[model samples]
Target chain A: MADVLLSAKDIKIRFGGVIAADGINLEVHEGENLAIIGPNGAGKTTFLNISTGYLRPQAGTVTFLGQDITAHLPRTITKLGIARAFQIPQLFLDQTVMENMLIAAASRQGYPSGFKALSRLPEASEMERLLELVGVRSYAERKARELPEGQRKLVDIALALALKPRLLLMDEPTSGVASSEKLEIMDILTAALAKEKVTSVFVEHDMDMVERYAHRVAVWNVGKIQKVGTPAEVLADPKVQQQVIGI
Target chain B: MTRRIKPITTAAVIFFLVSAVAPLFVSSWATLFALILAKGIVVLGIVLLLQAGQVSFGHAMFFAIGAYTSAFWGKYIGGGDILLYLVLGGISSTVFGLIVGLFVVRYREIFFGMLNLAFSMVLWSLLEKMFPYTNGADGIRVARPGLLGFVFTPETFQYVILYVSLLIAAAAFYGVQRYLESPLGHMLRAIKSNETRLEYLGMSARRVLLIGYVISAFLGGIGGTLVAIIQQIATPEFGFWTKSGEFVFIAILGGGAHAFGAFAGAAMFEWVRFYAAAHLADSWQLILGVVLIVIILYAPNGLIGLRQRYRQSGKRGR
Candidate 1:
């Protein structure tokens, strides 16, 4: 079996009366593109938040790289090589694309010391390469707020990649993007992720994106995993088709 | 890169030239200019916190602490050395900032502003009510401090103080400008942009904020110490909420675009007030209000933004 890069067992969380994550167990193996497909409020994002230390589950534990990290701070988890990209591009709107990339690269190298200028960061070449890989190199000088939705998504992914994480979690990378540009965004994203040799577990609602890129799919229904298997197997399942795909 | 470095170099040259030659030409304005420089230093501290997206309405408390610490050293410890007083002033206010920051850094926006104001008010009340130690509302008097063991006479005191204030302002501007270009400075801007994203990038936003707060307090202290020496008085009003408000006013007027913006704002404010008080007297504040309104509406980024817009329009015209 492939070594599990991230594992969560018996995870449970409640928001007032709503159970956001309930008795859920998941394992993401190294270097695999795993897609989580769920209806709205199905706890897919809640689970991702728990795994990334954004939300702490009321019960259950998350282990990453064989270390228990259920109570670690989000930054601590990030330093341990797990990075996340938000559904809404969480970028520095006032900063340029290259500046945003440099900030991430600086954090990963270790917080900048006193009087050490950004010019000395040593990540300029690598930042250029990452921006080029994600196809946003042309927009390097443009402020993040000025970028179109499709390009913003690409910049967000590039920012995540700059962290040099062993595992990357993406939440709805294509949701805000126009339908026509979804495939192109995913193409640049997946290609860059592969080239960086990063393991990814993404929550995606677009079935087409899942079918194209996900090596395996986990169907989440009402805070529980209904089934986990090859995309062909899960997509062909009658229950998944009837409920999730709304066949 | 050359384009960016050129402006900074030009600004540096102008700053040094003015500092070196201005004393000879306008020694009469030295006292007023020194006061502006001291306040500008405090506003520089505010600029740092503003970069982190945190505003403090109680920084005057640190200013008062710096002033009073220096006063205490002069009165009780018999420390006649101005350099030692400056260090003591900075250290005392930094220690206070470190302690208060532990609680203040956890709050954001209005809560942060209110907490700082509350602390400042408390300090103000203490200074007003403490009779023996602080000399109550009448305040404590500070004598002309000897610099490097050279006792300054009344005639030469203004020049010496002007030189010291200029030296401090230059150092503060250079240090802050360099810092804003640094990696940590980028992180500070990121904290304002999207703190959660910054944490996900692997930095503790709270820790970063606390460090910034402490540094700002240290600067405020140094500024306060200078002001106290200039005025030769540390009053209860030094820690008043309105005093803190003035720092915020200068910071916004200067715009937070660059470190030197603080000085620009301070100079404009001092000159405007000087002339307004001389001519308009009763209507000076009204004129100041009108000027601020105009700046807010036309140049919301402050004077720096106004300059940038002019340059851009000039380029377009060409």
Candidate 2:
């Protein structure tokens, strides 16, 4: 069995009487492409939030790399080799695309002397390599806001990869793209992830994309995982049919 | 529209020349000394804080802390040695910054700005209310220092000391610049752009912002201490909210494009204030207000915006 990169046991997050995440147990293995699929308000985003240290679970432990990271800060968690791309493509609108990537790369390296980073040299080359991987090297000089939605998503992915993270959490990675382009973005993502052997746990709504890309699918309903299995098994499950497919 | 000069670089170079070498040409000892130390150092602090996407309205608190600490130590504790006074002032203000920054960092956007103002006002009111320690409405005075156990009655040593202190303060402010332009600085900018996104990336916005806030406060203390040495008196008005507001104005005027924008803003402010005082002292406030309004409306990014506009237009023309 592949070593579990992230293990969550009975993690619960409550909003007053409503539980956003209740007794959710998930184990993400290294080098796996896992998709968490559910209807809106099924607690998929909440699980990602808790796991990434954005929203801490009120009860239960989150262990990453065999250590309890429940008490760790988000920056520390990121530094420990976990990076996330937001659903809305959180690029720095004011800065150039290259500058945004440089910031991400800087965070990974623990912030070297300012002058060294500012001077174009070895770090600049490294920046180019990452941009090339995302196929947006041409847009390097453009501000993030100027990039198309697909390109912005690419930039976000480049930023995540800049950290050289062991785990990549992507929230609706193909969001805002045309239905036809969604698969193409995922193809680009899969190729990039394969190149780095970076494990990805993504929350995606596209059933076709999930069937084609995910190694396993976990169906979430209300605030619990209704079913977890290989794409074929989980998609065929009656529970998923009622909660996710809504048949 | 491109001017062939980047605003950050232009502002930095201009301020550097003025602060570093302008005193050489100016023969008026009083004006030259004030230009180098009081105005220059205070403005440098403004530049540092604004770079981190924070605008301070409590810089006067640090400024006052520097003055008061120096006055108290020189008058009571250390027998008025100028060097000792500066050191003591810096130490006291740093301590003040750490305490105040902890509470202030919890706030965001406008609240952060207002909290700094409130804190400065608190310090100002406390100094005014505590008559015995601070001398209330009457400012406390510091005795002149003996030079290395030798008295220099002619006072040329004062000028040398002022210049040296200003140099060190300028260097310290530059250190802040180096940090801001670094990855850490980019991280702060990222927070400025989108704090929630930073959180999802496994970075804490609170921690990053807190460090920036503390650094700003620390330099504000240093600026304050420099002011104290020059003035020889510490008063409650040093902590006034208006003085804090002035730092904000200066930060904006300088364009906050680079570290020296604060200095440019401060120098212009002092120069204008002096010029107005000479010609129209009673209406100086009105004149200053109108100038600020014009700058804000015409140049929202201050001088920095002009630099950006030039760069963008140049690119287009090319």
Candidate 3:
């Protein structure tokens, strides 16, 4: 009976003829690691977008920390302690990793300009800690564009974590990382999430990672949740197995 | 290029010494002073616009606004008293900047650049069309601007006026540089790089750009006002598209990222224009075009890039 941090009721999103997300109800509790696993085009990303304020649902009410943030601006919603990372790992490529994380922290603190932050020592140290947490501390001085795929993903996660957010919406955090490196990155992410006690509803295609990391698995099919339960329960459901897993 | 020690210090020291003693070389103190002051002011606006990776092609409109404000006030009310003209000119430019920024900052990339040029040209055309009050092509006269109650008729006194104004502009440039290094400026760079990510971070891209736009315009207005006072005329030419192009050209000629780049660019721009006009006359644009093309191709960093390369070479040579 944990307190819910994010609660969405009957959310439906349509893109002309295609319904990206349809009548879905989901909740992520405080300090919980929730996974939304689905096949391609299941509207997993759209659901994440609606929850993070990037996309507005046609019908739904989203309450985060008991506040109705459905109509709030994306920046305002982020300020309310919900942070997200894109699947493609968006970063200021010309900037140093330290500079990237520092800006992220400043944005979270509502520092309007970089001149105001002025590369303060404390901010620099905080950036170092974030980099270390995400296992990219050695790459702090490197330009973001120079980093490899795995490190870039870590930097993206570090930026989201820099916000010190209570809830994180991650889109394919492990996407593009080598198959061997996926578990390592997930392990680092899970440890950081645990340390911060941050709740997350992340989308991933890897079932093994989901089973290993997800506290609760929500299987989505055709923009709707097919089942929500412990890994074993959801994996056992015949409808979920046939429609979602196709096993 | 690459950062080094010895050569950089030597170059900086030489530049500083030359500028400090430059006023002594010219017999006409007024020309020397006016040359530095006017160009320095214009460069301030260019610096601000370049911060967000934007090239403003219509700063001349603000310059024209400032010049007109000073001239209109100087001619009618106070005869262009130095103090009154500058204040009035700054205020007018600030207001115009806020208005134009509202419309211009919404556009991005080439569309943003094009809108600025179009807006400036519109102002120029309007000023020329409403010739009855603006004097159209004839231009407007400026009475000798004064300090306090004393009018500056002496060449030495005019020198003081220009020098003081130049100092103020320099200080303002420093302030802007400091602002650019702040968190707000970083976000602007972030916006330039990936605005979508900024939106995801919970900040509006447009609003941030608007703030930068208005600030740049305010500086542009200040430059225009200085030019009006120095030239003693306010014309529709001040708001011309070519004038805006001049600012963009100067900004690019100077490394947009460097604090002093715009100033160096402006000084070089004015000097080159003077040389081209004196020597090439009708073909001056051809020479200017060649120089621009060369810089764009080989040294895209402009003067700053050249300096960096020179220093790096010196280090390697050693």
The per-model lDDT (C-alpha) reads 0.89, 0.76, 0.78
> Tens digits of per-residue lDDT for model 1 on A160-192?
999999999999999988999999999998999
The segments of candidate 3 whose C-alpha lies over 4 angstroms from its true place after superposition are: A111-117, B1-17, B28-33, B310-318
Candidate 2 residue runs with Cα over 4 Å from true position? A14-19, A111-115, A118-124, A236-243, B1-11, B14-26, B29-33, B78-81, B146-158, B200-202, B310-318
* CAPRI category for model 1: high
Residue B133 error, candidate 2, Å: 2.7
Write the number of the candidate with greater TM-score, choosing between 2 and 3: 3
Rank order by lDDT, top first? 1, 3, 2
| TM-scores of chain B alone in all candidate structures, in the order given | 0.95, 0.88, 0.89
On the 0 to 100 scale, the lDDT of residue B28 in model 3 is 55
lDDT of 1: 0.89
Cα error, candidate 3, residue A225 (Å): 0.5
Evaluate model 1 with DockQ and give the value: 0.81
lDDT of 3 by residue, A6-79 (tens): 99999998888887878999989998889998888989999888887888889988999899988887888888
Q: What is candidate 2's lDDT per residue for B156-262, written digit by digit as tens?
A: 65565556566765676567677666666666777778777666555666777766666666666667766666666678888898888888887788677666666
TM-score of each: 0.97, 0.89, 0.93
| Model 2 chain B lDDT-worst window of ten | B1-10
Interface RMSD of 1: 1.1
Preferred candidate (lDDT higher): 1 or 2: 1
Alpha carbon lDDT of residue B260, candidate 2?
Answer: 62
